[model samples]
Target: GAGVSQSPSNKVTEKGKDVELRCDPISGHTALYWYRQSLGQGLEFLIYFQGNSAPDKSGLPSDRFSAERTGGSVSTLTIQRTQQEDSAVYLCASSFEGLNYEQYFGPGTRLTVT
Candidate 1:
């Protein structure tokens, strides 16, 4: 089977610009996750989606960041009013039935806000 995939491997946007990053998870996966990796922070959890519904979004840095999964297959992470602090490698991962330890990860989208 195919692995997870993300779009716009690298993105450069000016401050205050909004961007939408996409992710396509492995087929039949019931769990999806969005994480961010930055300097000093190895990897920070952003959101988790279980069957098209996100049960927890507490890891999001601020209100400017949002995420949604559809059809339990695709997900999008949107950053509104982007800032330099948002520059990082956004990683998407998927697992079957909420199993975090066996998740397959995408290459990630590197976003740089200047």
Candidate 2:
């Protein structure tokens, strides 16, 4: 089965511009996650979604960041009014149903705001 996939493996945008990052998780997966990793930094959980449960957006850095998952499948992360500090690798992962499960990760969308 195909694993997770993300578009625009690299993105360069100016401050105040908006960016939409896409993610395609494995087929039949019910759990999906979005995370951000800065240079020489650890992964930061941005959101987590499973089935029809409400998404956990506690990790979203600010109001400018938002995401949505449709039909318990693909997801999109939108950054409104991007900033220089928004430069990082946006990673998407999916698991079976539990946090203990092994989460498969996508290639990631690297956004460089300048």
Candidate 3:
């Protein structure tokens, strides 16, 4: 199967606008994760979904950030009312099982909020 894929490799938006980022995990991989990386910073976990279980969203920075995995394969991360501080790269990863397994990451989407 193919590795994870993300759309719109780059995005530039004004403050207060909304944006959506998409991720398509490898077929049969049941775990998906979203992460954010700011300039010079480490990857920050944003959300995770495993199987049919409840998604772990504790890592979301605020209510304005949300994500959903449809049919357990594709995922979409939405950021509302974007701010300058939100400028960064959004990464998506997936594994066969959980965090214990090796994760395959997609080329991140670089977002610039001004």
Identify the candidate with maximal lDDT.
1
Model 2: per-residue Cα lDDT over 2-113, one tens digit each: 9999998999999999999999899988998999999999999998888745456779999999888888888889999999999999999988997689999999999999
Clashing pairs for model 3 are none
Q: How much lDDT does each candidate structure score?
A: 0.94, 0.91, 0.91
Q: Give per-residue CA lDDT, model 3, range 10-113, as digits (tens).
A: 99999999999999998999998899999999999998888645456789999999898789888999999998999999999989985579999999999999
Worst 10 residues of 1 by lDDT: 95-104
Clashing pairs in 2: none
Residue 72's lDDT within candidate 2 is 86
Worst 10 residues of 2 by lDDT: 49-58
TM-score, one value per model: 0.95, 0.95, 0.94
| Candidate 1 per-residue C-alpha lDDT over 10-53 given as tens digits, one digit per residue, 9 for 90 to 100 | 99999999999999999988999999999778889999998999
Candidates in descending lDDT order: 1, 2, 3
lDDT at 71, model 2: 83
Q: What is the RMSD, in Å, between candidate 2 and the native fold over all Cα?
A: 1.0
Regions more than 4 Å wrong, model 2: none
RMSD of every prediction: 1.1, 1.0, 1.2
Q: Which of the two, 1 or 3, has more lDDT?
A: 1
